[model samples]
Target: MGKTTRDRLLQTLASAFELPEDVVLDLTRITITGNTQFLMENHRGILAYDPEKISLRTDQGETVITGRNLKIDSLFASEIMITGSINGIQFIRSRG
Candidate 1:
Protein backbone atom coordinates (compact mmCIF):
# COMPACT_ATOMS: atom_id res chain seq x y z
CA MET A 1 0.00 0.00 0.00
CA GLY A 2 1.01 3.62 -0.50
CA LYS A 3 2.03 6.00 2.27
CA THR A 4 -1.02 8.20 1.90
CA THR A 5 -3.34 5.23 2.11
CA ARG A 6 -1.70 4.02 5.28
CA ASP A 7 -1.84 7.52 6.72
CA ARG A 8 -5.52 7.83 6.01
CA LEU A 9 -6.17 4.47 7.59
CA LEU A 10 -4.30 5.55 10.67
CA GLN A 11 -6.29 8.76 10.81
CA THR A 12 -9.51 6.81 10.64
CA LEU A 13 -8.33 4.49 13.38
CA ALA A 14 -7.37 7.47 15.48
CA SER A 15 -10.84 8.92 15.14
CA ALA A 16 -12.47 5.61 15.94
CA PHE A 17 -10.31 5.08 18.99
CA GLU A 18 -10.64 8.67 20.17
CA LEU A 19 -6.87 8.93 20.35
CA PRO A 20 -4.39 11.42 19.03
CA GLU A 21 -3.03 10.77 15.57
CA ASP A 22 0.50 10.60 16.91
CA VAL A 23 -0.52 7.92 19.37
CA VAL A 24 -2.29 5.89 16.73
CA LEU A 25 0.53 6.30 14.26
CA ASP A 26 3.19 5.35 16.80
CA LEU A 27 4.85 8.73 16.60
CA THR A 28 7.40 9.70 19.19
CA ARG A 29 6.24 11.22 22.46
CA ILE A 30 8.73 13.12 24.62
CA THR A 31 8.58 14.30 28.18
CA ILE A 32 11.20 16.30 30.02
CA THR A 33 11.67 16.83 33.71
CA GLY A 34 13.57 19.96 34.51
CA ASN A 35 17.12 19.65 33.16
CA THR A 36 17.73 16.23 34.63
CA GLN A 37 15.68 13.63 32.88
CA PHE A 38 13.83 12.81 29.68
CA LEU A 39 11.31 10.16 28.76
CA MET A 40 10.49 9.15 25.24
CA GLU A 41 8.01 6.66 23.84
CA ASN A 42 7.31 5.13 20.42
CA HIS A 43 10.83 5.79 19.22
CA ARG A 44 12.38 3.90 16.35
CA GLY A 45 15.89 3.61 17.72
CA ILE A 46 18.88 5.43 19.02
CA LEU A 47 20.98 6.83 16.21
CA ALA A 48 23.75 8.15 18.41
CA TYR A 49 24.56 8.25 22.09
CA ASP A 50 27.17 9.79 24.30
CA PRO A 51 27.65 11.75 27.48
CA GLU A 52 27.06 15.00 25.65
CA LYS A 53 24.65 14.06 22.91
CA ILE A 54 21.96 11.59 21.95
CA SER A 55 20.04 11.19 18.74
CA LEU A 56 17.01 9.09 17.95
CA ARG A 57 14.87 8.33 14.93
CA THR A 58 11.12 8.75 15.16
CA ASP A 59 8.20 8.45 12.80
CA GLN A 60 8.03 12.21 12.37
CA GLY A 61 11.76 12.97 12.25
CA GLU A 62 15.07 12.72 13.99
CA THR A 63 15.29 13.84 17.59
CA VAL A 64 18.59 15.18 18.84
CA ILE A 65 19.29 15.81 22.47
CA THR A 66 22.31 17.55 23.90
CA GLY A 67 23.30 17.50 27.49
CA ARG A 68 25.94 16.70 30.10
CA ASN A 69 26.55 13.33 31.75
CA LEU A 70 23.85 11.90 29.57
CA LYS A 71 23.00 8.26 30.09
CA ILE A 72 20.28 5.87 29.10
CA ASP A 73 18.96 4.90 32.48
CA SER A 74 16.31 2.64 31.04
CA LEU A 75 15.56 1.27 27.61
CA PHE A 76 12.79 -0.88 26.17
CA ALA A 77 11.34 -1.73 22.80
CA SER A 78 8.87 1.18 22.88
CA GLU A 79 10.27 3.50 25.50
CA ILE A 80 13.53 5.04 26.70
CA MET A 81 14.47 7.01 29.77
CA ILE A 82 17.49 9.31 29.77
CA THR A 83 19.02 11.11 32.67
CA GLY A 84 21.42 14.02 32.47
CA SER A 85 21.82 17.73 32.67
CA ILE A 86 19.89 18.39 29.50
CA ASN A 87 20.94 21.44 27.51
CA GLY A 88 18.72 21.35 24.48
CA ILE A 89 16.39 19.24 22.41
CA GLN A 90 15.86 19.51 18.67
CA PHE A 91 13.66 17.77 16.15
CA ILE A 92 14.81 17.63 12.53
CA ARG A 93 12.04 17.07 10.05
CA SER A 94 12.39 13.95 8.00
CA ARG A 95 13.08 14.71 4.36
CA GLY A 96 10.66 13.28 1.89
Candidate 2:
Protein backbone atom coordinates (compact mmCIF):
# COMPACT_ATOMS: atom_id res chain seq x y z
CA MET A 1 0.00 0.00 0.00
CA GLY A 2 1.08 3.55 -0.74
CA LYS A 3 1.38 6.35 1.72
CA THR A 4 -1.70 8.05 0.30
CA THR A 5 -3.78 4.95 0.65
CA ARG A 6 -2.56 4.26 4.15
CA ASP A 7 -3.25 7.81 5.15
CA ARG A 8 -6.77 7.60 3.80
CA LEU A 9 -7.44 4.45 5.74
CA LEU A 10 -6.13 6.00 8.91
CA GLN A 11 -8.31 9.02 8.42
CA THR A 12 -11.34 6.84 7.94
CA LEU A 13 -10.59 4.88 11.09
CA ALA A 14 -10.01 8.06 13.04
CA SER A 15 -13.34 9.42 11.95
CA ALA A 16 -15.19 6.24 12.70
CA PHE A 17 -13.67 5.88 16.11
CA GLU A 18 -13.61 9.58 16.89
CA LEU A 19 -9.98 9.33 17.78
CA PRO A 20 -7.16 11.81 17.41
CA GLU A 21 -5.38 11.71 14.10
CA ASP A 22 -1.97 12.04 15.66
CA VAL A 23 -2.43 8.83 17.64
CA VAL A 24 -3.79 7.01 14.65
CA LEU A 25 -0.97 8.10 12.37
CA ASP A 26 1.77 8.24 14.95
CA LEU A 27 2.24 11.88 14.17
CA THR A 28 4.30 14.28 16.19
CA ARG A 29 2.74 16.08 19.13
CA ILE A 30 4.43 19.02 20.78
CA THR A 31 3.65 20.86 23.96
CA ILE A 32 5.33 24.01 25.13
CA THR A 33 5.19 25.20 28.68
CA GLY A 34 5.72 28.94 28.58
CA ASN A 35 9.32 29.49 27.42
CA THR A 36 10.92 27.19 29.92
CA GLN A 37 10.22 23.71 28.60
CA PHE A 38 9.15 21.61 25.64
CA LEU A 39 7.61 18.20 25.30
CA MET A 40 7.21 16.10 22.20
CA GLU A 41 5.57 12.78 21.43
CA ASN A 42 6.15 10.38 18.57
CA HIS A 43 9.45 11.86 17.47
CA ARG A 44 11.61 9.68 15.26
CA GLY A 45 14.94 11.04 16.42
CA ILE A 46 17.05 14.09 16.72
CA LEU A 47 18.36 15.28 13.41
CA ALA A 48 20.47 18.07 14.81
CA TYR A 49 20.94 19.63 18.20
CA ASP A 50 22.64 22.59 19.74
CA PRO A 51 22.09 25.12 22.47
CA GLU A 52 20.16 27.41 20.20
CA LYS A 53 18.57 25.03 17.69
CA ILE A 54 17.18 21.50 17.68
CA SER A 55 15.93 19.57 14.71
CA LEU A 56 13.87 16.43 15.05
CA ARG A 57 12.66 13.86 12.58
CA THR A 58 9.05 12.76 12.80
CA ASP A 59 6.48 10.72 10.97
CA GLN A 60 5.11 13.74 9.17
CA GLY A 61 8.45 15.41 8.50
CA GLU A 62 10.79 17.62 10.45
CA THR A 63 10.40 19.68 13.57
CA VAL A 64 12.72 22.58 14.26
CA ILE A 65 12.94 24.00 17.72
CA THR A 66 14.61 27.33 18.33
CA GLY A 67 15.48 28.63 21.72
CA ARG A 68 18.19 29.45 24.18
CA ASN A 69 20.02 27.07 26.49
CA LEU A 70 18.19 24.15 25.01
CA LYS A 71 18.88 20.78 26.57
CA ILE A 72 17.21 17.43 26.43
CA ASP A 73 16.00 16.68 29.91
CA SER A 74 14.51 13.26 29.17
CA LEU A 75 14.26 10.92 26.24
CA PHE A 76 12.02 7.92 25.74
CA ALA A 77 11.34 5.66 22.81
CA SER A 78 8.87 8.07 21.22
CA GLU A 79 8.87 10.98 23.61
CA ILE A 80 11.20 13.79 24.60
CA MET A 81 11.45 16.58 27.06
CA ILE A 82 13.60 19.67 26.77
CA THR A 83 14.42 22.40 29.16
CA GLY A 84 15.22 25.81 27.75
CA SER A 85 14.01 29.25 26.90
CA ILE A 86 11.97 28.30 23.89
CA ASN A 87 11.50 31.08 21.37
CA GLY A 88 9.89 29.37 18.42
CA ILE A 89 8.80 26.06 16.96
CA GLN A 90 8.51 25.28 13.27
CA PHE A 91 7.39 22.30 11.25
CA ILE A 92 8.44 21.31 7.75
CA ARG A 93 6.42 18.49 6.29
CA SER A 94 8.24 16.22 3.87
CA ARG A 95 7.05 15.57 0.36
CA GLY A 96 5.61 12.12 0.22
Candidate 3:
Protein backbone atom coordinates (compact mmCIF):
# COMPACT_ATOMS: atom_id res chain seq x y z
CA MET A 1 0.00 0.00 0.00
CA GLY A 2 2.92 2.29 0.66
CA LYS A 3 6.67 2.41 0.12
CA THR A 4 7.54 1.29 3.63
CA THR A 5 4.93 -1.40 3.59
CA ARG A 6 5.87 -2.66 0.15
CA ASP A 7 9.57 -2.63 0.94
CA ARG A 8 9.03 -4.48 4.19
CA LEU A 9 6.92 -7.04 2.42
CA LEU A 10 9.53 -7.58 -0.22
CA GLN A 11 12.28 -7.92 2.32
CA THR A 12 10.25 -10.36 4.36
CA LEU A 13 9.38 -12.51 1.39
CA ALA A 14 12.89 -12.34 -0.01
CA SER A 15 14.46 -13.45 3.24
CA ALA A 16 11.87 -16.08 3.94
CA PHE A 17 12.14 -17.60 0.46
CA GLU A 18 15.88 -17.01 0.06
CA LEU A 19 15.28 -15.09 -3.12
CA PRO A 20 17.53 -12.58 -4.81
CA GLU A 21 16.57 -8.96 -4.32
CA ASP A 22 15.99 -8.32 -7.97
CA VAL A 23 13.81 -11.38 -8.45
CA VAL A 24 11.84 -10.68 -5.31
CA LEU A 25 11.37 -7.00 -6.14
CA ASP A 26 10.75 -7.36 -9.87
CA LEU A 27 13.44 -5.00 -11.00
CA THR A 28 15.09 -4.20 -14.26
CA ARG A 29 18.36 -5.81 -15.30
CA ILE A 30 21.20 -4.22 -17.20
CA THR A 31 24.04 -5.68 -19.22
CA ILE A 32 27.01 -3.84 -20.60
CA THR A 33 29.88 -4.95 -22.80
CA GLY A 34 33.05 -2.91 -22.94
CA ASN A 35 32.15 0.72 -23.58
CA THR A 36 30.34 0.18 -26.82
CA GLN A 37 27.24 -1.81 -26.10
CA PHE A 38 24.41 -1.71 -23.55
CA LEU A 39 21.38 -3.86 -22.95
CA MET A 40 18.50 -3.60 -20.50
CA GLU A 41 15.87 -6.14 -19.62
CA ASN A 42 12.49 -5.61 -17.99
CA HIS A 43 12.49 -1.97 -19.01
CA ARG A 44 9.26 -0.03 -18.89
CA GLY A 45 9.89 2.51 -21.67
CA ILE A 46 12.23 5.12 -23.02
CA LEU A 47 12.00 8.54 -21.44
CA ALA A 48 14.54 10.48 -23.45
CA TYR A 49 17.07 9.78 -26.20
CA ASP A 50 19.73 11.60 -28.12
CA PRO A 51 23.07 10.94 -29.73
CA GLU A 52 24.78 11.69 -26.45
CA LYS A 53 22.23 10.63 -23.86
CA ILE A 54 19.35 8.24 -23.35
CA SER A 55 16.94 7.92 -20.44
CA LEU A 56 14.69 4.98 -19.78
CA ARG A 57 11.99 4.08 -17.30
CA THR A 58 12.11 0.84 -15.37
CA ASP A 59 10.30 -0.95 -12.62
CA GLN A 60 12.98 0.17 -10.20
CA GLY A 61 13.10 3.77 -11.42
CA GLU A 62 14.87 5.64 -14.20
CA THR A 63 18.13 4.87 -15.98
CA VAL A 64 20.25 7.36 -17.86
CA ILE A 65 23.03 6.58 -20.32
CA THR A 66 25.49 9.11 -21.61
CA GLY A 67 28.09 8.81 -24.29
CA ARG A 68 28.96 9.51 -27.91
CA ASN A 69 27.13 8.43 -31.03
CA LEU A 70 24.64 6.48 -29.00
CA LYS A 71 22.15 4.55 -31.03
CA ILE A 72 19.37 2.15 -30.32
CA ASP A 73 20.38 -0.91 -32.29
CA SER A 74 17.31 -2.91 -31.36
CA LEU A 75 14.17 -2.38 -29.28
CA PHE A 76 11.60 -4.75 -27.88
CA ALA A 77 8.71 -4.42 -25.48
CA SER A 78 10.81 -5.39 -22.50
CA GLU A 79 14.36 -5.17 -23.77
CA ILE A 80 16.59 -2.66 -25.53
CA MET A 81 20.02 -2.82 -27.13
CA ILE A 82 22.13 0.30 -27.44
CA THR A 83 25.44 0.80 -29.17
CA GLY A 84 27.89 3.61 -28.78
CA SER A 85 30.93 4.85 -26.92
CA ILE A 86 29.24 4.68 -23.54
CA ASN A 87 30.72 7.20 -21.18
CA GLY A 88 28.46 6.73 -18.17
CA ILE A 89 25.32 5.16 -16.80
CA GLN A 90 23.11 6.44 -13.99
CA PHE A 91 20.22 4.96 -12.12
CA ILE A 92 17.68 7.24 -10.44
CA ARG A 93 15.32 5.74 -7.95
CA SER A 94 11.99 7.31 -7.18
CA ARG A 95 11.63 8.86 -3.78
CA GLY A 96 9.01 7.34 -1.58
Candidate 4:
Protein backbone atom coordinates (compact mmCIF):
# COMPACT_ATOMS: atom_id res chain seq x y z
CA MET A 1 0.00 0.00 0.00
CA GLY A 2 1.03 3.62 -0.56
CA LYS A 3 1.78 6.04 2.26
CA THR A 4 -0.74 8.69 3.24
CA THR A 5 0.05 12.34 2.66
CA ARG A 6 0.65 12.91 6.37
CA ASP A 7 2.86 9.85 6.57
CA ARG A 8 4.85 10.97 3.57
CA LEU A 9 5.32 14.43 5.00
CA LEU A 10 6.35 12.96 8.30
CA GLN A 11 8.76 10.62 6.61
CA THR A 12 10.31 13.45 4.63
CA LEU A 13 10.69 15.54 7.77
CA ALA A 14 12.11 12.60 9.69
CA SER A 15 14.74 12.07 7.05
CA ALA A 16 16.25 15.47 7.80
CA PHE A 17 16.91 14.42 11.39
CA GLU A 18 17.85 10.84 10.54
CA LEU A 19 15.16 9.81 12.99
CA PRO A 20 13.44 6.48 13.10
CA GLU A 21 9.74 5.91 12.46
CA ASP A 22 9.07 5.66 16.19
CA VAL A 23 10.60 9.06 16.88
CA VAL A 24 7.64 11.27 17.59
CA LEU A 25 7.64 14.67 15.96
CA ASP A 26 6.63 17.69 17.96
CA LEU A 27 3.99 20.02 16.49
CA THR A 28 2.66 23.39 17.61
CA ARG A 29 -0.58 25.17 16.78
CA ILE A 30 -1.53 28.79 17.50
CA THR A 31 -4.88 30.51 17.54
CA ILE A 32 -5.90 34.11 18.14
CA THR A 33 -9.18 35.87 18.81
CA GLY A 34 -10.27 39.51 18.66
CA ASN A 35 -8.95 42.24 16.35
CA THR A 36 -5.26 41.37 15.95
CA GLN A 37 -3.55 38.01 15.88
CA PHE A 38 -0.43 36.09 14.87
CA LEU A 39 0.54 32.45 14.35
CA MET A 40 3.93 30.84 13.77
CA GLU A 41 4.96 27.20 13.45
CA ASN A 42 8.43 25.68 13.26
CA HIS A 43 10.31 22.57 14.16
CA ARG A 44 11.08 24.12 17.51
CA GLY A 45 7.44 24.93 18.34
CA ILE A 46 5.00 27.84 18.24
CA LEU A 47 5.71 31.34 19.46
CA ALA A 48 3.15 34.16 19.89
CA TYR A 49 4.35 37.58 20.98
CA ASP A 50 3.13 41.13 20.80
CA PRO A 51 5.28 43.34 18.59
CA GLU A 52 4.19 46.50 20.36
CA LYS A 53 4.64 45.09 23.86
CA ILE A 54 7.47 42.57 23.62
CA SER A 55 10.51 41.60 21.57
CA LEU A 56 11.39 38.00 20.72
CA ARG A 57 13.87 35.89 18.78
CA THR A 58 14.11 32.27 17.69
CA ASP A 59 16.34 29.98 15.69
CA GLN A 60 13.50 29.71 13.21
CA GLY A 61 12.59 33.39 12.96
CA GLU A 62 10.40 36.06 14.54
CA THR A 63 6.64 36.67 14.60
CA VAL A 64 5.09 39.97 15.53
CA ILE A 65 1.49 40.41 16.64
CA THR A 66 0.14 43.88 17.09
CA GLY A 67 -3.18 45.14 18.34
CA ARG A 68 -4.93 46.96 21.17
CA ASN A 69 -4.46 45.36 24.56
CA LEU A 70 -2.90 42.45 22.73
CA LYS A 71 -2.17 39.76 25.25
CA ILE A 72 -0.53 36.39 24.87
CA ASP A 73 -2.56 34.49 27.39
CA SER A 74 -1.22 30.98 27.14
CA LEU A 75 1.95 29.29 25.94
CA PHE A 76 1.78 25.63 26.71
CA ALA A 77 4.47 23.07 25.92
CA SER A 78 3.46 22.91 22.25
CA GLU A 79 0.85 25.58 21.48
CA ILE A 80 0.18 29.29 21.93
CA MET A 81 -2.98 31.37 22.05
CA ILE A 82 -3.32 35.14 21.72
CA THR A 83 -6.30 37.30 22.51
CA GLY A 84 -7.49 40.93 22.54
CA SER A 85 -8.00 43.65 19.96
CA ILE A 86 -5.34 43.25 17.28
CA ASN A 87 -4.12 45.35 14.34
CA GLY A 88 -1.53 43.36 12.40
CA ILE A 89 0.50 40.16 12.33
CA GLN A 90 3.91 39.41 10.79
CA PHE A 91 6.02 36.29 10.50
CA ILE A 92 9.76 36.22 9.88
CA ARG A 93 12.03 33.28 9.33
CA SER A 94 15.66 33.72 10.31
CA ARG A 95 17.26 30.35 9.75
CA GLY A 96 16.81 26.67 9.10
What TM-score does model 2 achieve against the real structure? 0.92
Q: In model 1, where do residues sit more than 4 Å from their true spots?
A: 12-17
Residue range 1-96, candidate 3, lDDT tens digits: 597798889989998999987777767888999999999988999999999999999976799999999999999999999999999999999764
TM per candidate: 0.85, 0.92, 0.85, 0.46
Q: Model 4 scores what on Cα lDDT?
A: 0.53
Q: Residue by residue across 1-96, what tens digits does model 4's lDDT show?
A: 243566678878798778864443433334554465544333244344443543334433565666677665656543355666767666677654
> Which candidate ranks first by TM-score, i.e. highest?
2
lDDT against true structure, model 1: 0.90
What is candidate 2's lDDT per residue for 24-84, written digit by digit as tens?
Answer: 8887788888889899999999999999999999988899999899999999999999999
- For model 2, the superposed segments whose C-alpha errors exceed 4 Å read none
**TM-score between candidate 1 and the true structure:** 0.85
Instruction: State, as a TM-score between 0 and 1, how close model 4 is to the true structure.
Output: 0.46
Identify the superior model by lDDT, candidate 3 or candidate 4. Answer: 3
Q: Could you report the Cα RMSD, in angstroms, for every candidate shown?
A: 2.0, 1.3, 1.7, 8.5
C-alpha root-mean-square deviation, candidate 3: 1.7
